[model samples]
Target: MHILMVSHFFESHLGGIERVAGHLSRQMIAQGAELTWAASAQDRAPVDIPALALPCVNPTEKLTGLPMPIPGPGGMAALWRAVGRCDAVVVHDALYVTSILALVMARMRGRRVVLIQHIAGIPFASSVMRWVMGLANAMVTRPMLWAADRLVFISDTVRRDLIGDPARRDYALLFNGVDGEVFTHIGPAAQRLPEGKRRVLFVGRFVEKKGLSILRAAAAMRPDISFLLAGAGPIRPASWGLANVHDLGPQKPAQLAALYRSADCLLLPSVGEGYPLVIQEAMACGLPVICGAPTDRADPEAGQFLRGVPVDLSDPDGSAARVVAMLDAPCLTLPERAQMAAWAAGRYSWAAMARAIMGLMAG
Candidate 1:
């Protein structure tokens, strides 16, 4: 089987969806399917995989931090041809131009299109922006979702929010997988900081929605606590110039696993997120996690291992104080960490995610 995957950016961007796409591509190949990945030329694709680096201009991403890659005429023509040859098309989300165009082209070519919707909505700080996003979802996203041959939601929260009635829509609730081999509990995790100082880790894009501002406030309130920020984006953590904040930049899985093992806890106070891959990776590495209440409860079973808190965009300082309180609390014990790792790895797998998607493609 030949499959074409369309995403806004590549795995090198350090976003969760792109990473999931890369994992699925490898798993599909291992399962005897020919996979061709196409994304914006903004970042590099997987080194050894077959890919079409579509020429695109990302002005929106530069200005607003939202990735919207618009392929040039030549790239669009190439994508049209690729759709004609592929047996099935798998799109990451319904929001991006690449995904929308892929849906249209796949439909025109009569190819089976599986829409893997990652997020339902983003609760932006701006009410105007929130309204705009809601309009986009209603006008564009829902239509594209309905037009696809099959729908797969990575988060049950997204599925429930978007398709309220489970029986009303034919969809699959598929969770993104984690690589347990790389992110596993070693023995007991030691404190990387000096004896009394605590290390708090935040892994993901440095964008506003990822709660960089709230984290900044939290770091200010508690100068004694160390804040290690991993992954890069328009919002530069180093520029914050806080003595307690350390920017580690983008990291690979192995490097991230190391950070998780040493860190006291993972902090992600972002809104409108599905269960982020970083949270799962942190849990797999036996690290405690503190994220938005909605996302922490994304998976009921996994929620047991997470610390959920309400995120108030209007009151970032108040939100920061709450995070500081969580930090001050006692850390997880070795046995509890081991239990968390066992549960996460046992439930999610890249191979299983691939198998389910392949089954949909086969149908």
Candidate 2:
């Protein structure tokens, strides 16, 4: 099968959906599918597979910290050609300009399109921005979702909230998978915690939606606890100048797995998310996770091991207080940690996720 996969950025972009696409692309290729990844030229695609780099200008991300890349005229034309040759088209999400365009072009060309919706709505700090996102979802996202031949929702919260009735809608709920080989429980559980302070790790882009400011507030309240931050973005945690805050910048998978094994807990305070790959990775490595209330409940099975706290963008201190309370709660036992790791390894499988997506594409 000649499959054309489209995303806003390549896996190197350091976001959830991009990473999922990268894994799916490799798995599909391993299963003997001819996959062509198409995305913004801002990041390079995997050299092993064929890729079409669409030249784009990312003014939205630069100005607002929302990565919305608009492909140039020439790049759009190139995508048009790729869609014509491909047997099927797979789009990551419907919100992106690239995704919306791909949906329209694929439909016009009579190619099968499968949309994998990753998130429902991001609760932005700015009221105007929130309103704008809502309008975009109603005007653009919903329409593309209905237009696609098959729809796959990664989060139960998103599917339930967006579609309302799964009994009537034709959609599949597939949770993302984690690489057990890379992320597994390592070393003694006691050795995981440092002697002096408890370490809380945050992995993902430093965006307002990711709740870095709230984390910073939490860090300020707890001077003794060390906050190890992984990933970089417009919002610089290093600039916050907190004594306990250590910004490690973006990390590779192996390095991230090491962090997961070393840290006392994993923290992701963002809202409007699907079940994040980081949460799965942390669990696979036997690290406990604390995230926003909505996402902690993204998946019921995963939620059992996660701790969720209400996030109020307006009241950073209050949000931070709740995070601190979760942190202060008793740590999971060594056996409990092992149990968490085993649960993740047994539940999430990259091969399974790839097979399901390919089946949908085939239909």
lDDT of 2: 0.89
Model 1 residue-pair collision total: 0
TM-score of structure candidate 1: 0.96
TM-scores of the models, in the given order? 0.96, 0.97
Candidate 2 lDDT over 220-328, as tens digits, reads: 9998998999998899887888988989989888889999998999999888888889999999999999999888877878877888899977678899999999899
lDDT of 1 by residue, 1-363 (tens): 999988999999889999999999999999999999999988987887899999999887777778888999988998999899899999999999999999999989899999999898888888987998999999998898899999999888888878885545899988888898888987445447664577889999988789988999999999888999989999988888898998989887788888899988899999888889999889988899999878887787787889988887767999998988888787778899999999888998999999999999899
- Candidate models: Cα lDDT each: 0.89, 0.89
Number of backbone clashes in candidate 2: 1
lDDT of 1: 0.89
The TM-score, computed over Cα atoms with residue i paired to residue i, of candidate 2 is 0.97
